[model samples]
Target: MNIKELQQYVSRFCDEKGFEGIPLETRVMYLISEIGELTDDLLEIKGATTEKQEVIKRNIGHEMFDVTWNIFDLANKLDIDLEAAFKEKMNINENREWKT
Candidate 1:
């Protein structure tokens, strides 16, 4: 689904699971925790054998999803329209010049 749909799904899921009352700061902490998990998965993959790397790769995807889900939930809590914000930011980036 698109960003808007994903945001709606997260909103509904949070409401259904009684997470709608969670504070923004707590949501940010959850997102940070997920990021740490994803980082751990990356580090594990780096040191893993080829066979073990495949397993860590799957866990990395799940961790990434968790990060994204928390972000969507945070945006919903903040009443931010991420889709519009993303488009606006991309437009600015598209027209900007890089020094490199």
Candidate 2:
């Protein structure tokens, strides 16, 4: 689903999960923790045996989803349009000079 729809879904979930009253800063900390988890999985993947690699890969994917879920929830709580912001940032990046 698109970000807007996913944000709405997360909003409904927050209500059900009682996360609607959670502080913005706390939500941000949760997001940071998810990022750390993702990093840990990446490190594990680097040294994983072939069979273990699949499990680590799935863990990494799940961690990444958690990161995005937190991001969407935070943006919804703050009334930010992430899709719009991402597009605007990409447009700005498209015009920047870069070293070869």
Candidate 3:
């Protein structure tokens, strides 16, 4: 499904499960955790870092999805339209982007 559908799906999931919504701070924390996990996996796979960097790389895709889940969760909780949001913000990004 597309981003809009996925956002609705994740939001519905929380509602259907009788789950309380996560706070924005918690969602951000999860995002950071997922990024750290991805970084550790990359470092390990490249053999460019310490053994301490050897986090379980196999499940990073799941972690990434989980991060999106929380993001959509928080956005839906706050009644944000992510599609329009991104489209609106793209103007700023486009102007600031360097030519590849």
Top candidate when judged by TM-score against the true structure: 1
Candidates 1 and 3, the one with greater TM-score: 1
Clashes of 1: 0
- Residues 13-86 of candidate 1: C-alpha lDDT, one tens digit per residue: 99899999999999999999999999999988887999999999999999999999999998898899999999
Q: Model 1 clash pairs? A: none
lDDT of each candidate versus the true structure = 0.94, 0.93, 0.75
Of models 1 and 2, which has the larger lDDT?
1
Query: What TM-score, to 2 decimals, does candidate 2 have?
Result: 0.91
Point out where model 3 deviates above 4 Å: 48-58, 97-100
Kindly indicate the candidate among 1 and 2 with the higher TM-score. Answer: 1
| Per-model root-mean-square deviation over C-alphas | 1.1, 1.3, 4.4
Query: Given candidate 2, what's the lDDT at residue 99?
Result: 93
Candidate 2: clashing pairs of residues: none
Ranking by lDDT: 1, 2, 3
lDDT of model number 1: 0.94
Q: What TM-score would each prediction reach against the true structure?
A: 0.94, 0.91, 0.69
